[model samples]
Target chain A: MTSDTALSVVFGDKISDEINDRVNSLADSLKKSGIKGITELCPSYCSLTISYEPDIISVNRLKRKINGILRKEMSVRSEDSVLWEIPVCYGGKYGEDLDDTAKLLGITPQELIKRHSQTVYKIYMLGFLPGFAYLGGMDSSIAAPRLSSPRKRIPAGSVGIGGQQTGIYPMSSPGGWRLIGTTPVDVYNLKREEPILYSAGDYLRFIPVSEEEFESIKLQIESGTYTYKSDEAVRK
Target chain B: MIEILRAGPLMTIQDGGRKGFADKGVSQSGVLDNRSMNIVNILLGNRKDEAVIEMTMAGGDFEFQNETFFALGGADMGAQLNGAECRLYTVYRADKGDKLTMGYAQKGCHGYIGFSGGIDVPVVMGSKSTNIRCGFGGFEGRKLAAGDVVSTGAPVSGITDNSYSPETENTDEIRVLLCAQNYMFTQKGIDDFLSCEYAVSANYDRMGCRLEGTAVEAVNGMDIISDAIAFGAIQISSDGMPIVMLADRQTIGGYAKIGAVISTDIPAFVQHKPGEKIHFRAVTLKEAHKLYRKEQKFLRKLSEKCQKGR
Candidate 1:
């Protein structure tokens, strides 16, 4: 029990696929249990923090329910992960640090994009801003250092690399992550019924597109004709 | 409709905030001072958690389109109705075209003004509170500007003032509870964090405020796998400086948080302006919950009284 309204259930201290799987599974189980007054069930790297309404359900009763759920064995789920094939334009004005990042890694821009787009990254959580997805799993060679001075504003849909994790900016915000590409898809949209396009426990594969294709997609989005390309990913 | 004659530095309509969207990376953006927000609503006999204009630092002037009863809560801004003295925590009846002018906040940083009915803003993601970072909700997902006309719902027939005066004196002391990653820091680091006084840095905003003072050394380093950030959580960055996470804080973060300020005292903690000093004291959860319940009971009683008066 950390605070009065919220409680943190820690699986482990380190970040790993096993720990994240457990965290997500527990979150789904709790949501399915039809528990009343559970406001937010936030699943992060290795823990799930639950914020509940104290007036609806007392703190002691909420603790007992959580403990009861914890007594059950955690199941690793892999079938429901949605694989979003994102269209990205790499190595240009959209990604200012592409050349510098490749130079630091002693690899060509072609090589960097090859390894980056090849792997299927899993989304462990969403945070830092509206609709910001924390996509885990990246090529070890693609890791880069944070900028000394964070940019005042990074445009939305900018794909950046930070340490071993890579993610899209979701919205324009001040950030220090090294930008390597930009996606044409609107990951976070206010007009849409569901403001956030993606969700945690999903997967993403970056598909590099030409400048012309990026413009076409943007026009399609504006004309209200574009639909996100995604399918349920079968876990490897 | 209320036409804004003069827009101050920052003004927005905030309610109880969006609650269920945190898992999707949406932070709860709401009024910083709920004590004041609720008191204003209760005073107006409006629904609890109704959207109200949150005027920060400097206040603004507006003209009512029709007759309505409005009340001022939270910080005192030397409000005047049609160029006459107006008091906080008291309901005032305004005629059509009556101009309400509010000056700079005399004591605290924010002021809440509640009309008979709540403001007429489309409910987005279960809240009318403005998520300024995301640029949605509130008035066009931005702060109100001069000449902008804002609508209000049908005013309740009459006003009910319980005549409750709230004690809102600013204090430098903030009570906290040790939790989360407090064990990550050294004993000396923890002692320094408690004993030393920290000044509120200028990097203060709706998201969080960075405190400039003695750095709390982390025994296992300051980095942690990003986890859900709570309002009033005191996070220690790599440099060891503490940043108090607030209402508009990101849903999750990677910094190691040593403790969280008690929920009840958050209204008082946010009053300190930049350069003002703040001291931290650790208290038991029992003590924290007692104060929280006390405030909740007070608000509940007001709502009940308002219902009966109506």
Candidate 2:
């Protein structure tokens, strides 16, 4: 955002772990710096656009403060990243596009599920709709084109593939993603203080479940007795 | 309290909007016309961030449940009270059982209704703005519907004689600061962008406004690493048309943007309805900041005058 709003700061140009780390580190530093007038910060793949109160702090002075922070040796903060195991039911009514997507990708329904559930994805960033995490590391074999026309309401927890990427729709939204499964968990529970389930730097692995199991999990969640299964993991 | 007798197509509770939640992908969904929202708020002597009812195109009927002071602003929607004419941009009293009705807007796209205090609604994620897409915040995380009842807080101050009439501009030209993947556009395309006229398409909302105009050729291609989006960013899609991102814009996007509309002009810019003509002008970062500071000063002075009864 440097040449743009005089409020945004771009760390790099492309998507790489090194660049993203720098972007995240800079955002963390800004948050802890107690730099007054900083209102909001949107961290993207390789850039950070900060929204601040113009009346409280001038752009020139804010730029000076950022420059001062950049000079310091920064570290990527990911020690506390959690590894969440998400359960999904991968066929029938839960996944409307499963049969069509498997046919388009030249794979059997079982094979599609196997490939999708095997990969542990890294939550690169949270964006689009609330709790919608843009995950990396989708298998090329499972890739499929998006719908020609987006549906008006894709239900929350529908796992879908769009091009070479895949993600979960934490809430109902109009989208073109090809749905392959449905998760029983409410990844974005508005009733809770923090609506979003996973933050950037967290890792999540999908576990295929039977439709019966999905119903059981759904019931448990409704009863508020389902505990989120997660494990401690070191940043690689 | 006020009961909505007829809720229009798009009526939502909005304030100054939330901050510091961009990391969770929440959009800054606030009032589209801040200038008018401020005008009504000032006339009623409410906090600048007080929540108000934002109506699009047509303002539906509202029945007063109690006696209170209220003001109207933004595009005049031909407001009437109890079958009589009701003025806009002025604070007026409404008695119990009074019904306020507004026909379609004759001037601007959005119309704002402000109370003496502010709409009493629980603030979620730090703001009262309704994020309709994400489905949270504001009044029950949704738009106001017919039969919906809303309450207002105690009046912070009394109404005054001070009034505001915005200095109208004849031209529809909007200034943009070219940055963030702007280099992808060719010099000739940039020239065409500055000189060309665009028509606002019917497909418009709080999310964005699409324009029908000359294609802005992107020599480096339209694809870019997804990056954070500003409120007024003009993203040139693969088809070459520019979409002006607005209050309900996504946190980040991958499309290449020519530039962002300066902050001061967003209110005036959003007032242009569908099929309206639009022009572009280039400005430096310094120039945009200077203009922003001037608007800030004007608002501050107006707020002080409204409070001091000057």
Candidate 3:
């Protein structure tokens, strides 16, 4: 599609598992093509935006190259996807809005936590902030709306629900999502080589934990000894 | 080296920007006015991607710790070097202990100050531009403050005392390319967006420029599935006010975008201050590309001339 300096290739008009998979596979193929002048490839829920240097390659030529690549069939292997199990502490000072959110959903705090942790969620994309993943797949029973008024600061590692989706905040910032829990793991670390923990095709599962367990995990993370659990068998 | 005596408003070190990081949710945070920043760097005979100090509105006091050449571009901030008035788009020699001071801008919103060898800052994530939101690049990923000491590399040799100024053109109408979601807005809404003059809102920042004018409401609503956003994407919020995303914009957005500002006109748009009125003119993608190629040719010729002067 027409844009200022980039060409946006939209796979679908809505967010779905098939659309996300197509977008991811297309991004992989484009990266493998070794196309020159492509400065950045940004993938979202249903589209991939290619930013390139106009001086190196004209837009028409780039479009033709991409179209030629798209004609070939490509598939992402299941082993390439990683599923991370993140430990979260719910219902305390860290999750101040947990009770209110449960009340709105007409469920107890324990039930809400159980339902949230039971299902695995897929990361649609990373945006809003660094390392912050836009996740999909939440139980309709615990679906809740965002706060009417946004808080000035939402602490890092906060797990919140907005509309029908749930996600975590990699860093502290202003937000309006209803907080349900907090994770002890560092989803984003600037000192790390990759910085961000999850990618577009990654999966995340929330595991409920106690306050003591959360503190212990935090200590291990700070001491540089914590290891994240990943399941590589899960395929989309 | 240079010591900041008074850091006024917001000042940050920036280069061309951190590219190839949008997938990780990182924005291309760089100078707001690309043309002006490039002009200052070219005038100082520095590399195109050399880091420079970007001052917003007003400039601060800086004491030169070493002898070097410096150039000013973009907004006219009423700069003075050791009690002598300095002209815009011209390079000047600064000796040790010379204090450079700049007042508030007479016009425009941002200014660029470039040294002969450029400012010295560690490159993080493949760039020296400060990602203020993430707090990781360009001088500890924060704005310049008083008492901060910044260093510079050795100046380039064989540079003559020559300067070039770009022709001043009054920019009131900016060109925009209709995007994929242009159909989301009604025909009347699209007409209103192009016909009306919108005033730059006071809530504008490096991330985006919010406009206050006739609300261009979508036929259904402004909600859309989150999609990739680019620099100069005009996203109409739920309230119907359009916000033009900038260099420091988020990589993705959920609002519907009617169009994107053309690259050739982005420099002029970014230099506008709050309360400034501007109109949008729709141009075909082919025309926009032609204009971009013409601008690049001019810049290449200018660089060649500067090299000859050296």
Clashing pairs in 1: none
Error of 3 at B155 (Å): 2.0
- Predicted candidate 1 versus true structure: per-residue lDDT over A83-197, tens digit per residue: 8989999989978999999999999998998989999888888888888888878988889899889999999999999888798998899999999999999998877898898
- Sliding window of 10 residues with minimal summed lDDT for model 2 chain B: B155-164
TM-score of 1: 0.93
Model 3 lDDT tens row, B36-108: 8887887778887688999988899999998988888888899999989998888898989999999898888
How well is each residue in B1-310 modelled by candidate 1, as lDDT tens digits? Answer: 7999998898998997789888899999998888888888888877778999998887899999998788888778899999999888888888889999999988778888888888999899999999887788999999999999889888786464445577645478899888867889999999999999999998988889899999998998988878998878889988999999888998998888899888877888887778889999999776877777788899998878777766
Model 2: pairs clashing at backbone N, Cα or C within 3 Å: none
**Candidate 2 error regions (>4 Å):** A2-6, A96-111, A147-152, A210-213, B160-162
Give the CA lDDT, 0 to 100, for residue B50 in model 2. 81
**What is the model-wide C-alpha lDDT for candidate 1?**
0.86
Q: What's the DockQ of model 1?
A: 0.63
Per-prediction TM-score, chain B alone = 0.96, 0.97, 0.98
Error of 3 at B235 (Å): 1.7
Best by lDDT: 3
For candidate 2, what is the TM-score?
Answer: 0.93
lDDT of 1 at B227: 92
Q: What share of the true interface contacts does each candidate keep?
A: 0.68, 0.64, 0.69
Tell me the TM-score of each prediction against the true structure.
Answer: 0.93, 0.93, 0.95
Which regions of candidate 1 are displaced past 4 Å?
Answer: A92-100, A146-151, B160-162, B167-172, B195-198, B212-217, B238-240, B275-278
